[model samples]
Target chain A: MDTTQRTEQQRSADRRRRELLEAADRVVLRDGPQASMNAIAAEAGITKPILYRHFGDKGGLYAALAKRHTDALLASLRAALDAPAERRERVEATLDTYLAAIEARPQVYRFLMHPSDGAPGEQGFDVGKHSAPVLRRMGEELAQVIEERLDLGPGTQQLARVWGHGLVGMMHAAGDWWLGERPCSRAELVRSLADLLWGRLAAAGDKVGGPGF
Target chain B: MDTTQRTEQQRSADRRRRELLEAADRVVLRDGPQASMNAIAAEAGITKPILYRHFGDKGGLYAALAKRHTDALLASLRAALDAPAERRERVEATLDTYLAAIEARPQVYRFLMHPSDGAPGEQGFDVGKHSAPVLRRMGEELAQVIEERLDLGPGTQQLARVWGHGLVGMMHAAGDWWLGERPCSRAELVRSLADLLWGRLAAAGDKVGGPGF
Candidate 1:
């Protein structure tokens, strides 16, 4: 285990991890999220031992996949938020981005959030380990961005965080139902969703919420 | 085949259906949503064929369960909304009702929304059949109430439906996450949630949503 050998091994491990994840996503996309570990290992052309070594178990693989999806969503959201847009337009864009993301990969999202609880040994997976952090981190990021976006005062971070979680939750709920029966057009849905977030922000009127005016 | 026997048989049949659902729910509660049909049949002290006869199959059982859960939620929401409280209080109460419902039976709600997609022949269940009408009816009810509560115009019905679905969805997403960690007080979560909707309605200022207030 010399330095050269160790370094080479590390690189090899990284490549293998990346390759496995890519293969997993491919199977998910093709066969939907319920595609089994057997299928994923087969897709990667790797054996079960190696796959388990990387992810530990089915839950581990799910968390890694969820983290990957969450990271991608965060990056996209940050990019959209960073774009030069006014308050209203930015709210619309941010929410619309989320709606599209959920609509796009519902199978993956559903698996991550709502894994089959009745399966033997599968019931023990802690959903909070994966989902709660996504919301908390997303809320944290959104709070900072929103404070800057709205030019709110220092104490508004908490309020912004509240709005962030609230809005994210709102989008998810609406998106889940909407995915089934698209009652409104994309534009309409985006605008309607934004109304509550932007409307509340505007109503705050340079205040951070206390005994209101 | 006599009318007296048939009517007597109908009552007994209805009772059996109710008992089976109750048994299934108990199994779900005890064993998680992934609780098998075998488990449910065992719980009811009946055989699988009889269970199949009552409901078409596993998919049918799931739909029936979802419908039961959805209907229960709808009834609770309607009662809260129908309460003779002030507008703002009613909003708070309604949102709280939703939060409580999700918190109370998270497993059932999760099962309805996120059933195990991996189960054999379980993939054929129609999720939309159970979830859509609930939102649609809620939207209609909310639209009427918003018109009365916020004094918005008739056109605001669409806006109201958007908010209804939006509010329902928001509560669900937040409730799902909140069930895990409970970051805030129930009162706080409900209040903040209501704030977003109320603020938007207030901002409308007796308009039907076009532009140029």
Candidate 2:
């Protein structure tokens, strides 16, 4: 009952949580979005009750997994941004990371986008709920860059937020669509998206008579 | 049977089809995306077999509703486009119709996006599968408009298809996001979205150098 014992117990619990999450990811990837709780528990080599004890339920588990995946994606994007490049190149790099993440783990992405066990009466699939942290980070990053560099106006932050959502949403839909129909190569799709986004952004920047894109 | 009797039976069957689809819509709205065959049949004052008879299975039923809803939306957009005005005005009106339809029946949209009983191990949602007719129409309309009016190159058709998908996907995600987070009024949201769409669109058109907004 001493502090060291308590700390040891907490560490063990955290390790168990990580193990369960890793099992859940494998099950989800293998079974697609409709992977069952029993399957997840089985994959973890644990009972369903133990799985539920660690994570409240399927939704909680999905949310935790979503947070994990979103953070990883954001980290990739950050790394992409870190590479010294032009503004447009940086945006492309970020998008490339986003799309690649979705491509790499589409089942997890779809499960996050629309969990099969979503509450019965909700009208709309709350994409933001599943990935609010990433959305917030994307908005902050874009808004910060626009304000610090572009100087679009007092409304730059709001505009950047709107644009950020638009871009994120675009990628979300485009990624899903591309997963279904490979009308173009991944590189081509990425380039087309980058062109559309960077073209508009640069044009808007020019209209404001601000920094060169 | 006599011709008149056959015609009467056909009319009655059509009526039943419409009734069942309406019931399905109501069930989906009330129960969100987890709407079951039993609930749909109960809503229609029929049995599950009868419900399945009309649409085969849940996926078939979803596909039927998707076609119905997508058709209705395309009709509204066509009407919006028919309004005599500038090109920009027409585009805004069309987008307004699209967003309004989604807002009006977000449950149908969500159900279409992700049926609770999606087939096991399905990789992609295949949104265009459910709405291919609309996508085709939108692409043809935009490409023709660009071709006839703008005199863009032969590649304009492909560009229009890509842009059509991009625009549709953007609205899809943005509409879902707005459903969850009403950061702005519908009018303001529509206007802002139109500005982004039309702004990028007009900029693209100008580079082609054919038409003036």
Candidate 3:
């Protein structure tokens, strides 16, 4: 094919792939992972053969969907990290970004967090694989802030890991509850979480004599 | 019925109920929630009628199992609160208790954390109902420690809530990851997590400009 034709074909394929991912998210959100491939194709305004031609099978399609979402989320988080702000403001902004992402696509969040082991042929969709790197990045960022503020030891990475896990967990639980019939606002939840984490972090430098000063 | 006969019947019922719950956990872990009622009953060496007699239905059985595990977990947390320790030690002890509980019953942890739409007849269960009170209790306990250590304003309860969520998240994630793969030693994970949280807690107080300083 000529260069222009090849480029046109690539653009067409890219658009179709994006459409499939968006459809996959919608189907999973509405009917969960059990949503049929044919249905997703239908929702994408494409035929089954085209969907199969692009993704090979249901697992491929889902993995592509997950990868797309993960990439988007990671990019957003990375951008949040670089945003100009003070330490406290940066932490809060990062958290708020995370919460909004999870809230915006809860089903995607659910799929990422909870892997169904029984599902046949579903492979390479591990949250930890994607999440761990983001987490490490976050920890490194926080560690820089912590180290600058306090005199931590060589075990700062481990310390950052703990903080990262704790923060992730708080966001996970708050997101889970927010999706339900909970009484709190998302802003309130995030503020409460920031207070909790910042409060503890601020306190870390005060007393090191094993609790009692 | 006479008191003796009634007492005998109740004792047998309670024993049978306990056996069924254990069997249910096994079946759920091995076969997911799709495990049939008859299979569970057979696994327990009891008749399906007896299973129904104890738990009205499969949903009832699942709820009861969750409640029982949650009760045990909450009780353990309560005991940790009573352990004579300093502020940081108490927080660490609470985390240890939680991690132990989740590690002991990874399947229960999965079941509890499963997503739901709050629709009736859905198999998804709510952890917040049972967990919220435990969180409140932990918060109150932590607040007591923080109050004694630092004269931060009346925001101790909120701080505790955030701490409680962070602790629960760490344990939950650790349990989820550790179920199939031994990423880190349980003791190490617990200690790392404790150090992270307690260290942060220690540092956070310095920033608050409290009166106790």
Candidate 4:
């Protein structure tokens, strides 16, 4: 085939793939982590075999779907992190950005981060294998940003990487718990997390009649 | 049966359960997350049926094994947190205790937290169902400690809970990556994490010719 024809065909294929991913996203939003292959195929107006041919398997579909969300979320986070603001402001903004994304589409967040195993329609989807890639990627991305922006003297790279993973884990675990039990407003959650990062935990006074934390 | 006989039977049954769990721990230690029922039974010098009879299923056995390790680890953490020292020391100790446990027996930690599914002999095991309980319990335990000791004014309980989960996540994610890569010494990892918690991230200066993180 000519280069022009091949390019046109590639564009069409990419468009078709995007359309399929959108349908899959809708089903995942409706069904959380137990999104079924059969349902996704139906949503895409294709047979199961065709869906499998496109994505390889349920795990592959989930990975692709997760990557789409993770990438978009990371982009938003990057903007927040890179905003022309003070470090504290940027940190709070970044935290708020993540909390907002998870709050807005908790189903997508849950599917990407905590796909429950043994749920109906979860066959061929190994939760353990897929659960950490998003978090890991976010950690690595944050580490890169930290390394590039901050001057940490010696071992800056190592410290940035540790803090990167550590901070991501903190945000994720707190967000997961908060989503399940909305004990406070999103703003409050953001402030509290930023405060913790700001050394408030060390700054807080000990309660009366007890040793300090 | 008489009360005396019943009591003796109960004690014997409990002893058998302990024995079986010990065997399972050995197998899991050797085999990581994919430790199988067959291997566990062989380690116990008992048949698979007896293993099943004792624990109900592989998941049950895993839960028991996880609880044993988690309980021990938590006790050590509690000691560290409650140590009669300055808050920073306690934090470092707690961090060190957790890091040491995971580092010493990465296989057990992996089995408890990141059990891979879809491996051979993993038919009924569900990684997602069981993965979070340990982290959840640890978060709750830490939350209690923070709430009891720290005076954060109004909304302290909620803040403590968030920080509890967040800190655990930070420690966990950092420890997981560190364990895998050993980018730095355990002492270095603990110090960096403590630094992050103590507002070092906010205190950090921007690298020359770049916006700060």
Candidate 4 ranges with C-alpha deviation above 4 Å: A1-5, A8-12, A35-39, A42-49, A117-124, A211-213, B35-53, B56-58, B117-124, B211-213
Ranking by DockQ: 4, 1, 3, 2
Candidate number with greatest DockQ = 4
**Candidate 1 off by > 4 Å:** A46-49, A100-137, A144-158, A198-213, B103-157, B200-213
Per-residue lDDT of candidate 2, residues A1-213 (tens digit): 499999999999999999999999898767665667788899999889998898886557777887887677777876785666665676678767877877887776666654442222222223333444455556556545444444334455555455556666666656666766667777777766675654432232111322222
lDDT, residue A42, model 2: 94
Q: Score the docking of each candidate (DockQ).
A: 0.17, 0.13, 0.15, 0.60
Q: Candidate 4 deviates by what RMSD? A: 3.1
lDDT of 3 by residue, A1-213 (tens): 499999999999898788778877787777655466677778888779888888876556666776677678767876775566655676678778888887787676766544332233322233333333344444445445444444445665455445555555556655554554344566766676666555453353322333423
Model 1, residue B208: distance off in Å is: 34
DockQ for candidate 1, C-alpha atoms: 0.17
TM-score of each: 0.76, 0.77, 0.66, 0.88
Q: What class would a CAPRI assessor give candidate 3's docking?
A: incorrect
Clashing pairs in 2: none
| Cα RMSD, each candidate | 8.0, 8.7, 8.3, 3.1
* Per-residue lDDT over A152-193 for candidate 4, one digit per residue giving the tens place of the 0 to 100 score: 999999999999999999999889889888988998999989
- Candidate with best lDDT: 4
Docking class of 2: incorrect
Q: What would the DockQ be for model 2? A: 0.13
Better of 3 and 4 by DockQ: 4
Q: Give the lDDT of residue B189 in candidate 4.
A: 97
Candidate 3: stretches off by over 4 Å: A1-17, A30-60, A103-152, A178-188, A200-213, B1-16, B29-38, B45-58, B102-152, B155-159, B174-187, B199-213
